[model samples]
Target chain A: MKVKIKSNAFLIAVSAVILGLLAGGLLMMSIGSNPFEGFYYLFRGGLMNMERIGNTISTAITLMLVGLSVAFAFKTGLFNIGAAGQMLVGGLCATLVAHYVFIPRPFYLVVIIFCAFLGGALWGVIPGILKAKFNVHEVVATIMMNWIAYWSIYYFVPAYLKGPSLETESKSIAIGQTLRSPWLTGIFGGGYINLGIFVAIAAVFVIKYVLDKTTLGFELKAVGSNRFCAEYAGIKVNRNVVISMMIAGGLAGLAGMAYYTGYSRNIQIGVMPSMGFDGIAVALLGASNPIGVLFSALFFGMLQSGKGFMNAMTEVPPEIADTIIATIIYFTATSVLFSRFWDSVGRRKRDKAQQKSDQDESKEEVSHE
Target chain B: MNNTTTKQSLFTSPLGIAIYIVVGLVLLAVMATNHLIGMILPYAIAYTIPLLMTALGGLYSERSGVTNLGLEGLMLVGYFASALTINLTEQTLQASALPLGLLAGVLAGALFSMLHAFASINLKADQVISGTAINMLASALTVYLARTIAGSGNVRIMLGIVRRDIPGLSKIPGIGTLFFTQSYWSTWVALIVWGASWFLLYKTSFGLRLRACGEHPSAVASAGVNVYGMRYFGVGMSGALAGLGGSIILITYSGEFNGTVAGLGFLSIAALIFGQWKPLGILGATFFFGTATTIANVSQVIPQLGVIPPVIFKVFPYVVTLLALIVFSKRSAAPKAVGEAF
Candidate 1:
């Protein structure tokens, strides 16, 4: 009732965020903690210093790319649940290039991009093919691909890229070999800030342009809305499905590059990368728009980066941030209730206007008589 | 035509294929090492029980027209509940603590699943997103709550259900060594549940109505059946069984609530698909995955399996599932109205 503006994706997202915050506050209260104190520390933690801001941005880079991947696939109505696997494969490729490629820095970026994209695309294409050619559900196929990639990385990291003493993670790359540049490091004052930020920003614009302007994007959307209609309209629906997944995989692959090569500088075994799923939330919050995904990823990145500081200062657990994000996604999924409410309000206004106009016409007729 | 159809069905059926794969793998293991089958049987069964229970829970939900991707999260709720209960009560209740903990797990899981039911069924939300929310919320909330109680976000119990042999059954030669020896009581409970589930699903009028709701909710609605009520029951059963599965894992094997079920819930959903939505199919699928996982874990210790890369065994279940999906794509046995909001 209080909402004056017409409900749109942005307002819906804002509403969900507010509800999520309240839910998180309720959780804090249930634990006998001050919600205000918890939130104060949470925001302060993410924006306390230049270094933390840099960390938040770097975190957002990975999340943004993964979000783009999910958002892109969602445009074509495919759920890419295998982003974690794609990220791992992409990270492995980047790690391999970082370790052994021994190329000049000028051309290294190109090589890394190609290798990472190829790796991720290979992983994505299997499920894409399954979905497009065989009618197998992408969710299940991607899930299988995710586990396969997980096990492969679990075996590969230890067997081939083990750190000097640690058998679980790959050896750290030199800063020069990684995505870090000296000037960016100096500006950030010791954070994981790197060229990945630029890449992420570029990806946001590119994905937006592709979705907004390209014929391919139109075809993909067409197939997504109604495959039979798209097919009848002379669009290759199957090709679009495969291509959409390919591009999505490539984006997630870049996320792996941003994370492993740019931020962490190493690959680990047995972890499925929670960013993969968080990206789904990011896509939903963004309403499957590339630009929207960027902002949502940044918001989530702030939550993830700030949680630790909040935990250190308050009695609240770091998991409260995740709890809040989960709650937001829940509210977003159930936003149909909000839509229904909006429709009711609109209907009441229309009815009132109709009655007022009818009363005016009757009064005018009486004056004329 | 009937004989030819039977032959073709035997060769192509998911059950037949799963059986062949298991038997073939067992034979290969036996040929390579004498003691391998006997040694791995107990571990395999232990692993299979959790997956079997979870997948069976999935069977109920999907058959009733709800695509439950939140099985993993529900399993975690049960895992946390059981661990918390057992840890809190082990000193006072002693032996009875285990049963209470399991009951707590089942109750918690069923209770948690109501949220998913409300969102997906009532609100007509996208089932996948709603299920994913359930997964994310349960995971984060459980860990957040667990930190308050356990101090480190993990709940561990000192008392686990110890493995024991059935006195009479253990003496039955080869079958004894494979099935009855060194088994946890939880295994028997899960098997009994599976048997009961099979009967409840196939032999009862209630089960037929539930299955009918999945196939055609409108048709069932015309027959004066409550589609929503049946779906709620289906989802509730899934939650209860998945919780029991989570509890069994804590009591028998894991002995801790570690804020995650390690994707076993997703694996069980894959098993449900692999099994073609039947009780027998699920048994085969879970058993197959369990054996593959056990082999992957123990391959390093076993001389015969050590020659092959552990990665092969680790990736086998997923790869096989993908292949099965491809093979069955033409005529899928999925519930028609599954994932649809009725």
Candidate 2:
């Protein structure tokens, strides 16, 4: 029973991925393209060469951090829908620091990253306080925060950080100010992949260690599993909620730093990064597990990066790729339902086997008597 | 002495009195400052109609125990369906085809919402996740279909142009100019729907059962009511209303269906919470939000307000929404079992 329960989430995630791909294939077929060939081109687009592979990892860096943010919050039974808002604030802060702060390269990098994390944490903390103190729904609060962040960026970017010609985005950061180290770029054969990947990887290990080995993680998980029960067990539920959200926000803030300073290198106005929402999908697909999130983020990264190639190689439109991604997310979101269904089937089989064994034992006892 | 005591009681009940006084002051200020504010009133009402309908739709779903965050997506689907219908039938049926287009949009919205219903209801999936999926799917599918059918990512409805006045109503002194002049017939439809929704939710047996399901599904189930059925009904009604709202926006306001519905759906949800899940409260919330939005749009054209940053005006409505939520959220009474699987 223990083993089955342990593997349940993994099984559901794997099946969801398969189902998502199959659905995508069906969609490809409907568009009059061969599914196999379409998938082939998609994979080729993401992994055709060293440059492509590096690009895929580069894309995954932000997703990885965002995914971790979501998964961490999920463990504490909080839905941080405001990750996008958090990312925006984090990115904005990092952008400000990157443009204005003059220091040694290492110190500047540290200061910018720290500021980004604090910005995201601030965004996360508000919703947390609202939820903990007032019992206001986090979902609604986070969504509201998202718009607030969006409009703030919209106002701040054009007013202060206007680029050369575009009124919609901020000025690009200098290369020396970015998270891109020359050694890392050189290792990836001159790909855009940067130090953000290392940060994401480091985050995964830290999060895993904290979740699996620390009392704080246990307490948070306990609160998540049953708030009332956790309270009865002397856990400060409100504190845990606030802490969980702060950590989650911090992770998302780092994602913003990675994206604005490392990936895109500038913030755009009038647009919320879709990566924030995509993180939810990544977390769901990963079953909210750190290791699972890492793998799923990479998979999603491939699909996103490979999509352009698929569009170019096939007669299929670019929108189909988005549709496919949405379909995958839809399937992943329903994985809990599938997991429950699978568990019931397993339970029924176990019950039948136990009944048969008991009958055989009863018959042998009667014969011995 | 009795009249004075009554006035004192009104003062004690500050919120109601405060709202009236603030509204009066704002109106007086607007009249003194610019006549353009008066012109924006009709436009504000037009904008409010869609939001009002969408919030009403959200109330139905949430009151029936399903957390429907997909109101925006449902609205978009409705918008796309109506726009596509209008586009396809414009040459043959001309202006007369709009009703059909509206019906198509409602049907499409209801049909799309079924996916959400199935996931959150039968599958007992996480309601938020299911709603998010619906949103993602709706945008992606609509954009894909629009591109395929129209050879572009946007669907433009060209046949039904709504810019007219109601015959006798447009002649009324101040009221006519604010409410009837240059209004879409959809405005009247929205008002009628609002009245009908109030009656259905507050005065009907089905509404009682639906609300019961949201609050205490097990209790309703013990009373031999099908909890699932009532939830489905609530979700279905929500879809229908959202669909209508989407159609109204397309025909009256935007005239084009893009892959997005701005953020009106999210704003409606904010209004839903702000209104404390009540019909009358929702109406007030929508009006306030609509006016704020109208002010934002009008600020760009008004020379005096031009001195202020344009982005501040654009951000004004959202900021107000956040403040409203923060103020009202704690006191607002939501259905107890919202986001819970039956």
Candidate 3:
């Protein structure tokens, strides 16, 4: 019964996704575009070419990092919408250190990544501190902080990177500091996908392990589940809130470096990436689980990758993918309702098992008595 | 004992005059810098009025405990609806189109916000998630609609509304250039909206009920006030203001709607927080932020600052916003039940 219900829940979610895609496809068709051709190209274009696959991988890596960031905050029952702002500062910090810090290529990469982590972490701390010390809401604090980070990087990057004349971005990284894949350089002729993707994957694993197996994770989960209960149990709720935000910030920061150092060299600080906010959708779709996030991130990466194909092969615009993605996210946000449906099925199964066992046990107890 | 305790308490209070000191320093810095003081200040004040109006809109929603994360998306819809309506009408009625367009924009904004109200208040969905979905929906819908109308992603008003030059105030000194020189209709709307909002929020029974709903919806509902209705009103009000802000950008600044309306929504959110959710506080916050942004945009005009890297000045608003939020986070008071749906 329980398994049946679980399958039913899964089916509902799957159907919702299919419905969203169909709606998007129909919308495209109504505008005189061939949906079939567009989808075929989306898959073909993104994965068909080695170079395109590399780009998709790079994008997936960044999205995963941001997704993880949002997931971490969600685990602690905090919504950190400031990931975009943190990423900007983190990317800026990493670039600054990479430009100024004179070191060997490999060593420079390590230091820059660290700088990104700290930069993002520091950005996160502002909201953490606010929520901890004051009764201020994390949502408002983080949202506001994102704008501040945007302006700060805008001013800092241009002023210091260039002496003062150019409106364009700062110069590229030093030859030693330009992020390059050693294996790709050795074999495939300068591929952009680096070991940073592995780093992101490893970070996901470590976070999953910590959340599932550690005391700190348990404490955080307890607080998230019920702050009143955790408070009664003598846990320091404020400390947990602060720490969760810091971790969330650090993950987003790393995502920035993974994108900049691994793929794009220049940092564009003026616009909010919308990537950070997209992380919220990914995290929701993934159910805030690490494994779920990986799959969800890949799905998003594929949609993004397929966009170019759809544009080239058919009349459908690449933005149709965005609408589909949003639809998926909307359905996933309501997953709680689906889960509740499964719970009822499980309850009936438990009741049947208890009745049978109790009847047999009661007969034996009567005989013994 | 009572006197000493009272004195100590006053010194330690979060709302102490120390906040005034920080605000003063920011103003002083703007004044002391030649380019910032002389050139950018006026543009900031002018530009800020629209955002201030939007923030007030958010204030109404948030004060009722529903976060309007869909603000950006809603604002976009508001802009396109208003712009398209105004543009279509301008051919028949040239000068009279402006007021008609704004009214149409407000109505459109209210309609757009109702969708959010339906999902969040009526369906009992998570507020933040519903808001996010609304934003995504808005972005796609606006792009598709605008593209259909204008052929490209861009939507230009061939004959947009003209600016009005204030009669006596137009002749004032250095300050007059920003406000009086080709003032858009949106600017007047902003001032009127701010005054009207202040009265609505602080001086009326409706405002009291809205605040009560935000703080404790269950109690408010128990007292016979319709909590859901108040929430719908709050969300609708924010949508209206944000919609006005979006149209103002098109009609006054760009005279068209494009994809460039990116950070303004977030900036307005920051402005609201920086303002400490107070009318007077918002005025100061919006003015400061507005000036910072205008400086970034027009610093190239100032030969002195033009010597520095332009991108730095351009992103200065985000930096200032970050710094201000960090500092303000330690001090500011938001609505009591901000993120909670009820």
Candidate 4:
């Protein structure tokens, strides 16, 4: 009854990953493919060449930022499902800047980055305001916001940002206007490598410092842990909610910029980025921790980058990776099942240690007598 | 405060909103000079039926205290199931294939919802997270299976319901022209289901207990009602209705299950909220959205609507939903214990 074992989140997360992989393996077997062979090609596909590795890293950058957005809002106990909307807004802003805003090279990048973040923040703040002021459910509000963003882009892109002949996408920015650099591109063997890598890495460090070292992080976490308790502690709960959503939105905006300007050349109309949804899985698998998110995003990035090669070699279909990721999400969602099983194991260990200590004490008494 | 002024607006009241919705729609009908609302009524009804059924599905689960974000996934499952059934049977069964396909969809949805029910009810998992998982799983699995079976990710059916006017009902004057003429039979089926659902949820003792489970589970439990069983029923109903909704889409206008219900599931959630969780409200709200959507779709081809940007019509419903959220925020009719992991 007195078992004081802490439920280890790390172990729980790892087990879920293993179970998810096993389920994916089972699915492969059901489909008449050898799971071992499927995995072999899958791993090789991601790391087969310098260019492929660069592609993988580029994919990871967008994922990491989106994951961070979800994780940040998650910490404040707000579900920022509108990351997709924020991404669209951010991508639109970055694309517009790249098209018209000519400035000194170094300053141009800063303006684009800031503009993207600001745009995303604008997209995110509405639901936050609705939740804070009117008590609207963020989920429904965000879903509505997503479609609004979707239709807005569907109209806005063709009318204002259309390329000379193409009606569905924005005019491609020149290499000078984009996030690409000659050195990075050379090192990556001219893959989609860009300055976004540095941005993602810098973001990792900044988020880590904020979460571990700052009062704002503490307040956000406090609100997440218990909203009324945080209010009792004299924290302004509503203000923190809005701030958290804004920052989360800003991060997702950065992800959009990373994708549109750094990864791809231009924004495509009528497509809501799937990374916004995938980021939820990344955040869940990482247990909403920044470092954990970075690693998981990298892992997902590998699966996405390798998918085509795996598909060609094994004919197992690209959706196999999605199936695995989805299964992982399901397992994480049922984490309550894992928590109970681990706690019982933890309790048994504590029982053995206590028993051994009691026997040693008895023997010492006997010697004293 | 702006809130106070907004409160004084006529549309804030439910009756006012309903009247405004009808009047506003009538204005659109009147303005489209030389156009027959009858010519457009069938398409509008087609769009409204799916949303109506799905939102009704949502109505069940939410009133029983489970926030079902997975209705989209459930609908997809039904969509796939019906498509597979029809694709297999269409050659042999011919006209008979449609009803069997619909049955398959309903059954598949109910069975699939057990995953959600087990997670939320027995495992006591977070309902929203579990629902999200359901969505992810459905999307990947349906497409994967479709790719395997169809050799392509899309499943197509050659057969669809033929639109016709009702014999006696079409003879009536103004009302018949709008409601009965050039209609798919599924429209009446949907209306019947709506009427039945209203009775079941509001009048029956089973309905009372199920609703009470959402409001106060412990109180219901003390009254000797098995709360878990009631919730299971609620979720099951949602799954079945959503499946019906999805199947209707396939057998009517779509004639193919290419997956991706284009976010109709979430839109249905919006309609449910805008409808204020009542059957009548849902009917009105979905119809309004259906009208808005139909206008957006057909307006691109029509000359007069081209003057106003199609995007305006396309984005109208979603924007109005946000406004409705703001107006309805104070007296939200959301189930008292909805989304709580009880």
Candidate 5:
């Protein structure tokens, strides 16, 4: 029964992906473009060479972490819409540590990473507390927090971390201060890939372990499924809510570290990270599972990285590519409908089997008579 | 003695004369300090109208039990539709293009919101996810279509209407300066809509059933009203108002569609919450937020307010919104069955 349920989830996810792709194809055809060629270039652009592959992985690194953050919050029945705010604060903190704290490379990196986690956790906990104590809708509070973080960065970057000419972003961090280790870069043949990819992979396993093998995970899942039932089972629902948000915030913060330090090497002002919201699509497509998130993030990473190349190759504009991605997200968001359809199919098959068994029993009884 | 007694009673009432006195004094101080304050007030009013209209839209949807977080997206779709219509028909429709464009916007917004209603009501999808998807689709589709059709990513309309004074009303003292002068016609339309919304929501039988559905769908269903239909109606109304709000902004303020609404839709949701889903409360909240936003833009004209960083002025409204949500949310009684699938 358990295996059947697991397979059902897998089937639903696969079908959703296929349907989403079909929709995207239809959209392409509507725009008078060859969907097949568009997809071909899209894949080629993402995996044409080692350098491109490394860039794709680099892009996936942030996505994987953010996806995990969102999936983790889902496990606890909390919608962490404040991931963008958390990312901003996290990236800002890491940037600050990277600039001021000059120590041994390993120690500085560890300190900076920890600071990023704490910053994200701090931003996340505000909404958690508001939800727990004040009954404030986390959605509204988190959205408000996003704007606050956005403007705060706008204020902070120009005043303290202003680059030489660009007023919109901070000065780039030196290589030693960044997450880009020489060894990793060397293996990627001078690609943009960095140590953050490894961190993201490790996070997937760590999150999986924590969720599957811990009492805390059990309690959080219980609360998510039914808060009243969890409370009746002697779980502290409010504390779990706060703890889940903090952990989710911490994961997103790590993503911020990867993005600002590893990929871009600088923090930008006024722009909320689109990856924060895209993480929702990733989480949904992955069915909110850590391992699933890893694969889905890789897929999305390919789409995003390949979009520019696809635009260059085909008459299809970049905006159309965005529409395609949004279409996929729209389909994935309605995954509940797909599950219901699958459930009905399963039920129908079971009903047919039961009827066949009954007919065979009746025939045997008549033969004995 | 009788006159003093009457004055004392007025002061002691909850809607007290003292409150008006305080407001009057603050206005007097602002006008005395900077005459530009009077000029900014009209702009604030103009800005507040769209927000107020959008909030009213949110009120209808939420009251009927479906959370319409796609207001921002709906607004964008409406804005794009209206802008395109106006831009294409400018040569033929001329001055008549404004009303025709608005009608197109309302229809487009309603049609777009039907996608949301279908997913949330029939498919029983997560409302927030559905809303987010709508937002993504709106921005992406609008930009894509705009690029393909217009050969540019923005749709610019040529029908820039001149602001008209309301004849004798514009000559009144401080009131005329703050309310009547330099106001767009859309402002009056928005006010009329707000009054109509108040009447419909409070005085109509349909409103009672809609509110009941939000609070308890089973009870509403038991009473022989279609819960799903009511939800659809609520969401459709929200979309129409949001569309009108978007059209108003394009016609009166921006004079173009840019595939974005600057998060005004979300701000309207904030206003809805701040107002506790009441029409009058929404009006007051919109004005407060409108004033807050206008201050950020008008700071350049008021030299005395220019010293503080412009970012602070920009951030102030958001900060105030956050604070307001935190303080009022606990006391605010939202519909019990909101965000739940019927």
Candidate 6:
């Protein structure tokens, strides 16, 4: 059973990659870009050299965090469109802690990340509490909260934390606090890849552990699978729902830290990055699994990082990347229907084999008689 | 039988009076904040009217069981198209083109929203994903088209429609001056849409059929109603109204097009949900948000409170929106079949 489940997961991952590639190819064709050249450049631009590879991996780290946040919600049957909002809030909070909160060197790093996580979790909890207690749709709640987050970040960053100058941004955090890849420099010859990537990897393991090996995970899975059953079984399903949302929100917030502190080198947030929302697509494509999220995030990161190369290599507008991503998302949204169709086909084949075996046994009995 | 009845009654929900109370208190608070109240209140009213108009459109689609999530995208197209049409036609008429623009907005928005309806109703695509496509398509297409038509990303309405001043009400000492004076055709359109929607949703057989299609399409189909047609009608109406809202926004708020539609369409969705999918409730939500948003933007006028930074005040509306969403989602009962497709 374990082997079968593992193989099925593998198949789904492979199919998702193929679907993404095919969709990208079709988009390139529509835009008159040569697929081969486009893809070649995509690879070359994102991973051709150590520096390029490091940048891609750094981006993937953040993407993976947000992607996992989205997947966590999906696992619990909540569509968290507020990953963007949560990330913004998280970024804001992480910035506050890193800049204002006094702490030691490496310990401060963990504290700031935690602060980001808490900020995101708080934002997420608003929507979760609504959904759990009031039966409000998280979709609408999250969307609205995103605007609040925008204004909050806008006001807080510019007004309260403005440096000695009148600049809209805050004072830059000390260089010691910002994430860098000192450890990975030995391996990749001083690339941009940082400890954040390791954090991302560690997150995947933790999510897997919490989900597959814990009682809390069991309760969450039960509630997600069917609220009525969980409720009837005397579980506080609504609480678990809220908890799941908090976890999801926290993960997304960490994504913001990975993005702002690690990659952008600034604590200030202006526009809601598409990364938060794109995580939804990534989560969906990964089928809401932690390991799947890791790969899907990498894939999406590579695509984004490769857009410049793709544009240069072909007449295909770089905008084709967005079109392809959107198209793949469209397909992924319908994946539930596809899975249903596939399952029915499998069931039918099994039924036919069972009937044949029964007939064969009856004939053997008659021959024996 | 008595025991069973009691058990059933325990499950039966209470009326959502708390929503009204919270909404009322929030409005009163906005009104009470004297320094910032003047700017925020009018802005909120102006913004709310159009958004409420769009939410009515959403109410129709959702009540009919197909979620029109592409509303934001459709509104963007509506906004740009209305701007272009008004600008182009006004060149010939010089002034009457504003009303003409509203008409054009409705038509263009209807046309765009049909694409969303077709994808969901015909292709059976997930409504959320379909909405996302429409949104992206609208965003990209609007930017491209607006640039092409206006010869720039920004299109200035040469002679924009001025807000009509109500003589008696505009003279009212303080609050009346803001709410009643110099309102756009959108305010009238919003009221009319609200009335017409109320009538259509509750009084007409078509609305009943639409609701049936949304809640239980299979049953409605068995009852001899065309589920697809009803859903299309609901969604199409939603698109047209959202378009009108978008156009109104372009003409009144920004006086031009600069992707200023921002995320109002999505906000309208929030209003729809916050309003609990009811026309009256949606109106209140629209007004509430519009007021809060307007107050946040204009509260910078008072130098004393200005020290607090206007952004903090700007957070009020969103906080309320979040509160309302939490309050409503948990308590208010949605239409029996809100997101389910017919």
Report the lDDT tens digits of candidate 2 across residue range A1-369. Answer: 000113677778777777778887887788778999999998899999887898899888989999999888888888888899999999999999999999998788789889999999999998888888866678778887888899878888988999998899999999988888888888777767888998899999999999999999999888888889999999999999999999999999999999999987899898888889888878877878899889989988888889889878986666665666677777766666667778889989999999989989999999999
> What would the per-residue lDDT of candidate 2 be over residues B128-222, giving only the tens digit for each residue?
87788788788878887887688789888776556789899989998887777888888888899899888887799878888888899999999
Q: Write the per-residue lDDT of candidate 3 for residues B198-287, one digit (tens) a residue.
A: 899889998988988878889889989999899989999999988888877777667787754676776788788777777887887788
**Poorly placed runs, candidate 6 (over 4 Å):** A1-44, A100-105, A163-166, A183-192, A309-319, A336-369, B1-42, B83-108, B111-126, B129-159, B165-181, B255-260, B303-309
User: TM-score of B chain for each model?
Assistant: 0.93, 0.91, 0.86, 0.93, 0.90, 0.87
Give the C-alpha lDDT of model 1: 0.88
Model 2: which docking level applies? acceptable
Task: Give the per-residue Cα lDDT of candidate 3 at A304.
Answer: 78
Sort the candidates on lDDT, descending order.
1, 4, 2, 5, 6, 3
Q: Judged by lDDT, which candidate is best? A: 1
lDDT of 5 by residue, A1-369 (tens): 000123456777787778767877777788899999888888888899888898899989999999999888888888777788899999999998989999988788789889999999898888888888867777778888888888889888989999998888899998888888888888777777988898899999999998999999999888888889999999999999899989999999988999998888898887889888878777877878999999989988888888888889997667655565566667666767777788899889999999999999999999999
Each prediction's DockQ against the real complex: 0.58, 0.48, 0.29, 0.52, 0.47, 0.32
Misplaced by over 4 Å in model 5 are A1-7, A351-369, B1-34
CAPRI level of candidate 1? medium
After superposition, the stretches of candidate 1 with alpha carbons farther than 4 Å from their true spots are A1-7, A349-369, B1-26
Compute fnat per model: 0.80, 0.57, 0.37, 0.71, 0.71, 0.46
Q: Positional deviation of B45 in candidate 4, in angstroms? A: 0.8
Strongest candidate by TM-score: 1
Give one digit per residue, the lDDT tens place, for model 4 in B257-316.
Answer: 986888888889888988888899899889988877887898877776778788888888
Among these predictions, the greatest DockQ belongs to 1
Q: Summing lDDT over every window of 10 consecutive residues in candidate 4 chain B, give the lowest-scoring window.
A: B1-10
Measured against the true structure, the TM-scores of the candidates, in listed sequence, are 0.95, 0.92, 0.83, 0.94, 0.92, 0.83
Per-model TM-score of chain A alone?
A: 0.93, 0.91, 0.85, 0.93, 0.92, 0.86
Q: Give the worst 10-residue stretch by lDDT in candidate 3 chain B.
A: B1-10
Q: How many clashing residue pairs appear in each of the predictions shown? A: 0, 0, 12, 0, 0, 10
Better of 5 and 6 by DockQ: 5
